[model samples]
Every structure is written in structure tokens, then in C-alpha cells.
Target chain A: MTGSEGPGHQVQAIGNDEDVVRVRQLVRTAAVAAKLSLVDQTKVVTAASELARNTLVYGGGGEAAVSTVDNGVRRGVRVVFSDSGPGIADIDLALTDGYTSGGGLGLGLSGARRLVDEFELDTVVGAGTTVAVVKWAR
Target chain B: MERVPILKIGSVLLVSIQVDMQDQMALQLQEDLGQRIVDTGCRGVIIDITGLDIVDSFVGRTLSTIASISRVLDAETIVVGMRPAVAITLVELGLSLDGIRTALNVERGLELLARNAEPDTFDDLDLLGDPETTSP
Candidate 1:
């Protein structure tokens, strides 16, 4: 898994509890590769956990893909969670805190957004949801 | 499927989550803990997370969930050994871990639980063991 292409770091399944752990581990590895500090690594990993769980529980299953980002001198890690399921109806409401369609603290979206340096989300009602987050080394 | 051993010391249940747990494993631990609390009649629960250098909202909520559920079953929970980085991340991530008590280490967590849940248990250490001779 370590010997891969430049942008391809690690990809893991996000269908169950075990998969969530794998996602966290893979994100940590990517964070390390990006030379992120300990705090940054933890924040990215935590955000990854929330997003992965959201993929599994809400999206019915997805794949978490983490890769390294290098902009000349600075390096970063980006994680993308893509799922094909019943897509969200309202993007604005979904990103709002205390708005949960399922049983959770409703922090999956907003809380995860706060942990990363960059966050992007796309959802089509009949298609699916794709959330991408990036944490740069500091 | 992986089990974090639950040890019953006197009337307290102690578990240190030192493994990289999957989602299923965490849920199993929760169930096992609830059952152990009922079976042992333990008055207190102390979980040590000194081994976990990183904790996300999922893990944080798991700890808080266990604590909250244990309260319903008449058991007090004290989570100890959270790394400073994890705490800061948790705060930034918006997980306050509300309604859960925390401590610095296992010894302190145990003391906190005992002091609040069963003050007499510490006073009557002789009942569990001759502490002067056995445990150092």
C-alpha cells in the first residue's frame, strides 16, 4: 500500500466499524507523509473518522481516499470520501450544527469542517455525496 | 470482535483502551461493559486512555456514551489519560464530551470514582486485600 503512485496514497472501505479504524489509520499515514505536526495529524484523523462514519451510516457505504498534497515547499494531506446512496436533500441544512438526519451529535459535518484547513462538499439528490477535506502542515 | 479485557477489582470495573479499535470493537466493549457492570455489581468504572495518543469525535463520543449509559445503570465513570492534543482537537471539533468526568491517570481516576461513589471502599481496603503486604 505504501508503494503506490504519486497522488494515490491509501484507500480503504467505509462500510463498517472496522473500516472506520482503517480510515483513521490511513489518514494518519497520509498526514505523516505530509509532514503535518502531531496536532494537525490528530485533527485530520478525527475529521476523517467523522466523515467516514457519515459515509457509512448516512451514505450507506463509501470509500475514503487519502493522498499527499505538495505545493512546492508546503505539503498537505487531503482526504476524499465518496458514497453512492440516498443523497442529502438540503446541503445548507446538513452543514448546520444540531441538524441530524440520523442518531448523532449532528457534528459530523460542521465539526469535521472546523477540524480541517479546507472542506468541500457536493451532493445530488438522486446521485450521491462527495466530501473532500485537506489539512496542511504547520 | 476484539475484546478489551474488563477487570473487576473489588467493586470497580477497570478497562484501559490500548488497542486500535474498529467501530464494531468499540460497540462490543460498550455492551460488555454494561453487562459486566450488572454482573459484578460494580459501583464505579474507570477507563484509562493513556495509550491512545489520538482521539477523534467518534472515540470521544464512545467514551462519553459509555459513561452516560453506565450512569443509568448506577455506575460512575471516570475517563483518564487523554492526551493534551486530543483534548484540544476535541474542543476544536466541537465535542465537549459533556456529562463525562475525566482524570489525569488511572490511579487518580480510581481515586475520584472511589471518593465519590464509595468512600467507604477506600477506608475498608482490608476487605479486598491486606494492601500493606500484597500490592505495592
Candidate 2:
């Protein structure tokens, strides 16, 4: 589908494994428009890609949202990736580096959080997971 | 994914990029690879990115930093097997890899290093003086 326009942009896609690439592209476009530096933009996109992949691989399927925020002189982008798969049982253990559930390095959540200016995570044992990431222009 | 072994060849270390070398893993790998090069006392490093379909900014910057870290340890670093699409995308995305050296293939990169090590070929250059002018 096509991404929305204006100060706030949005796009929705399936949580399939292939959608991870599209989410990255979307993050790149939104972050660049928000005036993030190339390195910062890449960081955001990479984090989003990881989260999206996790949502698809572990969570079964999910949705990703992107929006630009302006608070006075401060400007940034916020990405919220939500999924409806088996939720994380231990957030603390999952956040640890090198502890992976999907044959990965278990750096997805922590690494994604590190790349952004702000990070938040919400999950229910039997419900699902939602990860929010925010990166400001610097 | 499985953790691939870091290939060691004499004074050089060669690593094949795995598919999951993204996000935090990418960052950790960068640091680990840099440290390993120093710990091994290798003179050179080659990171083969043949498995990667996309090379984002974080990966690009990490690779560049690894190259610099290798230099700090007196080891040379070379990035090889970057797909044309990935290369073009990195340029389009405005990611600058200033201190990094790239090669089309690992073999060519190794050959380059070998050539640099031995540049003196007797047959390549003629004698400075003519044969008649030389002392008997």
C-alpha cells in the first residue's frame, strides 16, 4: 500500500517475514524527512527492521506505525511496532545481549532501544507485544 | 542463526557476514571483530559481505569503524563482496564510508595485498645505465 503524506505519515502492512524489508524502507523515508542525520536514520531503520522481523518470526504477525512529532523546537519521529503472537515471557532476560530466541544474537530489542532517543515496551504473557521507539534530530 | 567461526589465516582474519548481522548484533559484531583482530595480532582483516542483500547505514558505519579499529591495532581491514544493489543503495542513502577500503572480491583483495608486499620485479624495470657503459 501507499504511505500517507503531510506532517504525520502512516502505512500498514502484514507482519510476514518479507515485510521487514518494507518497514525498513519506510523508516528510512520518514527518518530522513524528519531531518535525522544519515547515521541516525540508518540506526532507526535498522532497529525497526529488527523489531519487525521479530514480530513476524516470533509474534506470528503484526502492524507497524510511523509518525513525526513536533514539541516546540524539538522535532523527531516515533515508530510503534505491534504484534499478535506469543508475547515475551521475560522482558528482562530478553533485553540482555546475546540471549536470542530466534537463533539471533538477542540484540534486537536492546540494540533498537540503544539507537533511538527514547524506547518503551509493553507486553502481556498470553496477549502480544508492542514496542515504541523515538529518535530526535541532532 | 548459528554463530559462524571467525576464519584465521596466518596474520589475517577473514569473516563471512551472516544474515542476522543487523541491529544490535551488527554493533556487537563490530566491536568483537575489532577486538579479535587485536587479540590475534593479525596484520590484516577481510569481512566478506556476500550474504547481505541490504547494507544499511548502521552496518556501513560499523564496518568503517572496524576498519579504523583494525588500523589502531596496526592491522589492515578490507571489506569485500558488496553487491552492486547494496552499494548503490548506500550511496543513495548518503552513507559515507570514509576510512574504509573495499574490494570487488576476496581473491582480488588478497592479490592486492600480495602485490603490495612484493612490488620489486627485476624484469619489470631495465638497468639505469646502458650495457656498453657498464664496467667490465
Candidate 3:
């Protein structure tokens, strides 16, 4: 998975629980590499865990890419979780705090958004879903 | 499939999770705790998470469920040793972790449980002087 990715990007498969843990570890490494503070690292890592699990449970398994980015003055870590499963029909509903299709707390998407500096969601009804989030060093 | 070991301490059961638990492992801990609570008739359960770096919604929900299950079995559950950062992130994540008790560390958690170990029974009420004899 790492071979096909760019030089700085680390891609990991999210097929099960272990993959989710690996995703979190990879994000943490990238976050540290980008010089994120301890609190920021914690926040981003927690967000990564949520998104990775969503990719596995809701998205029926997928992959995550962790990359460090630089925006001139500041550096940051960005993680993208992509899944080729049943795409979300109601993005807003899925972002609701208490709304869940899989008996979870339903806080994965919304909570993840709050944890990072930038949050983006791209999805299609039948194709799949991709969630990207970035947390910059402070 | 690594299991979280549950240790017996007097009337309380202690589980110190020193692993980066997966979702399935967390669920297994919940089940194991419930069984231990019944088998030992423990009145309190303390889970130490000082070793964990993060506690996401899945693990948080499992803790809540375990607390509820322990309550149903007449046992109190206290989660101790959460890092400051983890707590802040959890609140921001909109997970209040309702119905779950927490303490600063294992020692404090034990104190909280000991306070609830003994209820105010009829004997204790009698010790406070009979109502008829102590009438104003």
C-alpha cells in the first residue's frame, strides 16, 4: 500500500479493528512529524480513530492515507479515509449527533469535524464516500 | 484477541488496560467484566486507562455499557486515570460518557467504591437511636 503512494503519503488498509489501530498510529506519527502540540496530536489521533472505524464499519472497509502538509508558514497533518461501500444518502443526517444507521453513538463524522482544523466530505449515493481532515500545528 | 485481565481486590474487581484495544477487544472486556462481577459478587469495578493514549466513541460506549451492566448486577464501575487531553477531546466529541463514574487514579477510585461498599442498613439506623426514644 505504501509503494503506490507518493513519497510522503502513507496509505493503510482499514479492513478490521487492527487496521483502525494502525491508522491511528500512522496519523499520530504524521501529526508528530508536522510538529503538532500534545493536545493537538491527541485531538487529531482521536479524530483519526473515529474516521478509520467509520470507514471499516459504515463504509464496509476501505483505506486511509496520512500525509504531512505545509502551508508556507505552518505545517499540518491530513488524513483521508476513502471507502467503496454503500455511500451515504443523507450527509446531513449522518452528521447529526444522535443519528446512526449502525447502532453507534453517531458522533464519528460530526465529532471528527470538531477535532480537526479542516474537514471535507465527498460522497455519492451509490459510489462511495471520502472524508478528509487536517489539523495544523499550533 | 488479547483479553484485559481482571484482578480481584477485596470486594472490588480491578482491570488495568495496558493495551491499545481494538473494538472487538473492548467488547470482550465488557463481557468478561460482567461475568466476573457475577462470579465474584464484587460490589465495585475499577478500570484503569492510564496506558491508553486515546479513548474514542467505540471504547467510550463500551465503558458506558459495562457500567450499566455492572449496575444491573449491583456493582459500581469507576473508570480511572484518563489523560487530560483525552478528556478534553471526549467532551468536544459530544460524548459526555453519561452513567459512567471516573476518578483521578486507582487509589481515588477505590475510595469512591469503598464509600458505597456498605449501605445504611437497619442496624445502622437503630444505632442512631430509636425514633420513639429520641422524640423531640
Candidate 3 CAPRI assessment class = high
lDDT per residue for candidate 2 within B1-136, as digits (tens), equals 2354578887678988866453556667777777787688777788889887567545676788788888888777888998775665455444557898888999977876566544433333335544655555
What 10-residue stretch in candidate 2 chain B is worst by lDDT? B117-126
lDDT of 3 by residue, A69-117 (tens): 8776788888999999899999999998888999899999999999999
What lDDT score is found at residue A1 in candidate 2? 15
B12-108 per-residue lDDT for model 3 (tens digits): 9999999889998999999999999999999899999999989999999999999999999989999999999999999999999999999999999
Q: Model 1, B1-136: lDDT tens per residue?
A: 5699999988889998898877777788999999999998898998988888677666777888999899999899999899888888889988888989999998898878767855665657767787685688
Error of 3 at A34 (Å): 1.1
Best of the candidates, lDDT = 3
Off by over 4 Å in 2: A1-6, B1-136
Tell me candidate 3's interface RMSD.
Answer: 0.5
Error of 1 at A69 (Å): 0.5
Tell me each candidate's i-RMS in Å.
Answer: 1.3, 8.6, 0.5
TM-score rank, highest first?
A: 3, 1, 2
- Across residues A43-101, which tens digit of lDDT does each residue of candidate 2 receive? 67767876787777778888888887765565677888888778999999898765788
**Residue A75's C-alpha lDDT in candidate 3?**
84
